[model samples]
Target: MEAKQLNIGDNVKKFRELKGFTREQMADYLNLSVSAYGNIERNKTDLTVSRIQQIAEILEVDLAQTLNFDASQVFNITHNEVIQGMHSKVENHNHPDEYKEKYIKMMENEIARLKKLAGEA
Candidate 1:
């Protein structure tokens, strides 16, 4: 199987959406124009570590998580099982559902926390 490529821009976009932040809000917070912020999400900008750190801080996510976010693993939990020819994937394994639920809950909590922080700020 080919290794999946990680895209920091995509991850940043995901986190921003999860936090219920609009592009305008993010751009304003970063003192950037909307088009400039859009470039970041489109992977048109070559991001530096400092920029990545700034984005992570703004999104309220850990730098490591932002750098390492894998959409396939998170969204396609049965990928490995399918590759192995396991036809009874969902029925045979409840892990995916549990994991997805937990992940959703975690994101929800994070969103709430960010909202509270924003209110405070």
Candidate 2:
């Protein structure tokens, strides 16, 4: 069986959504136009290593994790499972509920810190 190709843009989009960030927020943070930022998520732009690192920092994930993101590792099987006997296997790497709670708390704290910085500016 051929290995599935990983899409970095899709990975970025998923991570961004998980962190409760809007495209506009990310664009503002990166000082890019919204359309320019959208190009990254849409894979229209060829990303550099530095760009990937910057995105990883914004997503609060390690660069390696961002590159290796597997949706099945995080998403609940029941929610994404296909009906009609087409089995979609999801391997649980971390306890989804616990992991999500911790991640959400971290993101919330980060958001507050950014807001404070924005206010001070």
Candidate 3:
């Protein structure tokens, strides 16, 4: 089965609504036209990494929280091994515990990077 595409823009919009910020308010904060901000929330325009971080801060959310990265994508993963005739192919060699550790490490590193960027801004 194919994994469904997750839109980061939707997540950002949801968090914005949760924070009670209207499009106009957010656009004003970002110094962008309402149309531009609307496009972003609607996933019409590509947003830069810094812009995403700014939005996350505006909504008082962690950048990682806004991103919602999955273990499979962030870390190399395989579900199982495939046996075809005499040939065997390993899907993912990492154990569940290993994935967990990598997940935690990745999250921590990302959070730290964002914090550093925020400090510089």
Task: Report every candidate's CA lDDT.
Answer: 0.67, 0.67, 0.64
Task: Show where candidate 1 strays beyond 4 Å.
Answer: 1-4, 70-121
For model 2, residues 4-120, the per-residue Cα lDDT tens digits are 765788778777766556798778767799999999888788888898998877665678766777544443311211122224332223345755774567568767988898995
Best by TM-score: 2
Q: Locate the minimum summed-lDDT window of 10 residues in model 2.
A: 77-86
TM-score for predicted model 1 compared with the true structure: 0.55
Give Cα distance to truth, residue 47, candidate 3, Å: 1.2
RMSD of each: 16.7, 16.0, 17.3
Two-way lDDT contest, 2 vs 3, winner: 2
Residue 95 in candidate 1, Cα distance off native in Å? 23
